[model samples]
Target chain A: MTATNSFFHPAFFYIALAMVLPFIRGRFYYWRWLLLVPSVVAIISVISMDHGTYMVIPWLGHDLILGRVDRLSIVFAHVFAIMSLIGFIYGFHLKEKAHHIAATLYVGGSFGCVFAGDYLTLFVFWELMSMASVFLVWLRRNPVSTRAGFRYFFFHAVGGLLLLAGLLYRYYAVGTFAFTAVDPSNAQFYDYLIMAGFCVNTATIPLHAWLSDAYPEATVAGAVFMCAFTTKTAVYVLARGFSGFYILAVMGTLTAIYGVLYASIENNARRILSYHIISQVGYMVAGIGIGTLMTVNGAVAHAYAHILYKGLLFMGAGCLLYAAGTANLDKLGGLVGRIPLVMIGYMVGAVSISGMPFFNGFISKTMTIAGAAHAHYTWLAIGLEVAAVGTFLSVGIKLPYFAFWSKPIYKGELRPIPINMYIAMGIASGLCILQGVYPNVLYNLLPYPAEAMKYHPYTAWHLVQSFMLLSFTGLGFYFMRTVIAPHPGRNLDFDVLYRLIVNTFAFIICKPLAWMDNIWTNVYRIFGMRGLLGLGTGTKWFDLKGIDLVVDGTAYTVGDIGGVSAKAQTGRLQDYLAWTVIVALCVFAIVWWL
Target chain B: MRNWLGDWLEKTRIKHAKIWMGVFITIMAALVIFNLFIRPHHVEFGYDAYCGFWAVFGLGVCLLMVFVMKKIVQPFLAGPEDSYDSNE
Candidate 1:
């Protein structure tokens, strides 16, 4: 199963597809099947490929492993490829080349991340993932979406900088850019910086504000594609690198609770789901932080299951946005009457997310809790259990009840949901149920299959425990229904701090600097030139003729450059974000080239 | 297929709404009963060995989460829907 570092890398398929697809106009509309080609190839390539390294290049007295195939990477790659196929199918109706291209590159970036065997390679693809995804938010093409895209892009730029700094520091300290698991007891400052960077992507608590801030503003199918990649990639990296870190264990449980707390009050369907992404990712994170063989396997298994169900969930919500023109719970009701199949599809995702007895979440989520309990982390296990209750309440019961079954039945003229969206949902739903009923399908793909097989999800006691828990959660919702009813408002998270800091920086730093620069420029133009003209001497003729032509002209241009630097802070978020990504890419691209 | 299902749900399902509620109640009762008979093989936490610990845990936590989030925190936390769109 071993081989030299030269072969077809899986990411090449999506990368090639992105490059070739722009030329695929006209026929692209007729042969819509063309876009699905890369996903199929990627899946086959990922599934058929054995564990080995490929495409290793000696660079700067080091090696860059583009394809580091292992069971862990393969499992993530398997789900990414599968989700990519489903996402493309769901989005097939869109005529926008930008959507398909952005999605293609985004998927390619994730593939690059999954198989990346070196920090440098991973960081390059990491930025690619962030950059490609910003388009998904911006493609929504509204003022709100545009603003959210900037914020999303801004936070990821900061995160990418952190990772770059960490990796570079680690290379100098350890003398290698090799991406490997770190020993927790021996973890250094650079490790925490790197972990902090990865934590931002995982939506870990305070760092999580960007996800909820951005995702609800994304395009419908764009959200579905997004739901699979960003946080989960962070989970993959954390499981790979920062596994035994206790801060993650504590913070992870807190993040799980924190996400649900927000989802409880959120009115936007997509926003609610966005918060739950943080919550569900919390479990995987907790498992990784606990750092047991069982917990790590649980984390991976949960990730695999999560991609299927979460994608299905987003697809369901995306259909609502597509059909009803809104995913706001306050604006939606009795959707079951019109889009009953959507309700079914959505409920499949809903129950799956809730870890209802016969769903994928039940199988995967419990594995982590069981691992925590076995490891004697009593408080973490309890916190996760409480969070699970909140999960069932918000995502499972509250969301479905309000959106589908509640009164004031939606009497509006609803757009018909395309058949393709339903087909994609149906596929995801079937897999969720299949994996739930027969755990081996997912179990066999785990990093530690034999260890995972020993963890049963469907014992009589376990089933009773889950039903009793989720069913009673339903009952509690019945009593508290009026209290928890969705309302029209947004709750603040850490983004408020970010907004404050950014606004303050603009006010305190840029505005004054610009004001001073303008004053100085005016002073130079008014005083210096006026003094020269008033003198009316041979100096004026000399200044205007030769020295002025060269020196003063240079002085004015350089002065304007300073003014422009200061005045460039037009208090617009996009201004700050615009050149940042370009500069980031060019710098990294140069370093990568080197 | 979607049309048929949508029709049945709008018509038939609505007509049997109360019946469905009763069925849900019965299912809940059946679950509690089931928990009594099939206890965990070994209780990791001592309280989990109790017949209805998870039922109480689920109800208590769900209610707490709802009340705490919606009533307590949300009133403090929530703002206009367009809160973040200020720059826009």
Candidate 2:
């Protein structure tokens, strides 16, 4: 079946077009109504769909295909669609049309990637996503943000290029660009390369630097949008393609540990959350790497839970950034008194991400721990438990405490957060609670069978242990509060190596090189070889007094005499004509002798 | 003494009674609601290990709640806007 039917696949096409609608439509109220089109389509797409590729060709030459609305793609697409609606509501008061378009295109592009069944289609959507999301970071227009956006785009562009290469190679190797199953038995260089492509965006280890660098630079709403999609999609890809790769277990564990360490020391609120994103996704990735039926199920479940809790945390941080104009730990305090709703929102998110018993994260994270233990990865299980404690320390206690409970470092009264922000946050908070209470709702969305996965986060003992671990950590936080100081500033992360040393070196080199080049050109015009060369060849050496006296007379005479005495060049114009004659005679004699 | 006092006040200390109280209530509400509403389904692996994990966790949480209430919460109340922050 050809995948093109414009009328049927209205969701993908309309959302794609809706990206540009903001620029043309102009009115603020109109865009809200326009946002409804995709939300409706998302619901429609989920409820009533047939499996083969769906293509739309309303406009000729635009071979648009909204392919594969299967359960796997549907889960990602549905969350992305819902996220866009929530983001729209949260950012309803934004005035910039450019940002609105950028945001819409970014979300729409992610959805497009979700529905793409072929590598060609995925590549197109991937590059568009790379281009579109940069605007979210660039919207701030501060020097810090501008630099961050450039770095973000640089990494994304590199990822997209790698994806293109992998896709082309896969197509060459298998003779098709279609999204078919990759057999673990036939895992080749292309498969590994494709997985690497996914890892770059997954914020996988060395590639993980961009998340902390760019996220804090984005506008609050932009950061909220960012928290939902990119890395989660990478997890989705891993769950699909490289499920049995054992190295991923190591990769995921490192990512988790690396994230916790950075987050522990970081002060910028959004950056802290960004590092936590890596940490949490590490759990998901490790689950995928473990690759048992239960573990894969856990990976999908974690993705679903992560989207909600992480988005909630970002939104809370967004709220703080929105009202107080800063998200530094030291700069903010006592905000809970003023904006009680925001604090409630933040704490809900914190608990959910911390995997405390009865929170959404607890439900998902437990599966990975059990899966790891069941697989006899006892050390890994213990590591995850320790990481869980760190999670609560950093987010559960630290975020709300500093932003809401900490002493007010600055005096300010914020106007009540807009009603729409409340509505968005409320929905997130409700989902966090609901999903925690009823895991079956999210479990049902898993591509793998939930029953096949055996794990429990909430038996009496599991509750006691998690509580105990968190308790000890809490004691550590309180007793060590004086030593664990949170300075009111951003701590540099992975990119600092590049930003400080490498970039400074480039600056140190390039600045002087350019200056030297500039000053030398000026100096060259006055004297030196360049100045000499620039003096027209027609100018005789005698015409210049210094050259004439210095070169032609006493200087040349003495130099020539010295040269002849040294038998330099034989001094023979036939050996000074006669000695030249004698030398020529000697040359002839030598020739005769020979 | 005065210098030490100034330094102490300058640190990033947490404040707010109502907020942490709300946090405590929310957490309890979540625990109770999930415990009651979501019935735990039994799998082949018994809840023995699971029970142990939660039991220990609960005891620790109870104990820590006391310390948090005393050390962190009692001292940091939301009074006037500047209660927690002393700006020079």
Residue A39's lDDT within candidate 1 is 93
Candidate 1: how many backbone clashes?
1
Against the reference, the lDDT scores of all candidates come to 0.85, 0.67
Predicted candidate 2 versus true structure: per-residue lDDT over B1-88, tens digit per residue: 4334333333323334457557755664455444444333432234423433443443354344334433464333213322111111
Tens-place lDDT digits, model 1, residues A498-581:
766655544565455555555645655666764565554554465457544554434433332222332322243344446655
Q: Is the docking of candidate 2 incorrect, acceptable, medium or high quality?
A: incorrect
Q: Write the per-residue lDDT of candidate 2 for residues A132-155, one digit (tens) a residue.
A: 788899898775676567668656
**What clash pairs does model 1 have?**
A5-A55
In order of appearance, the predictions have TM-scores of: 0.90, 0.73
Query: Given the true complex, what DockQ would model 2 score?
Result: 0.05
Question: Runs in model 1 with CA error above 4 Å?
Answer: A1-7, A503-594
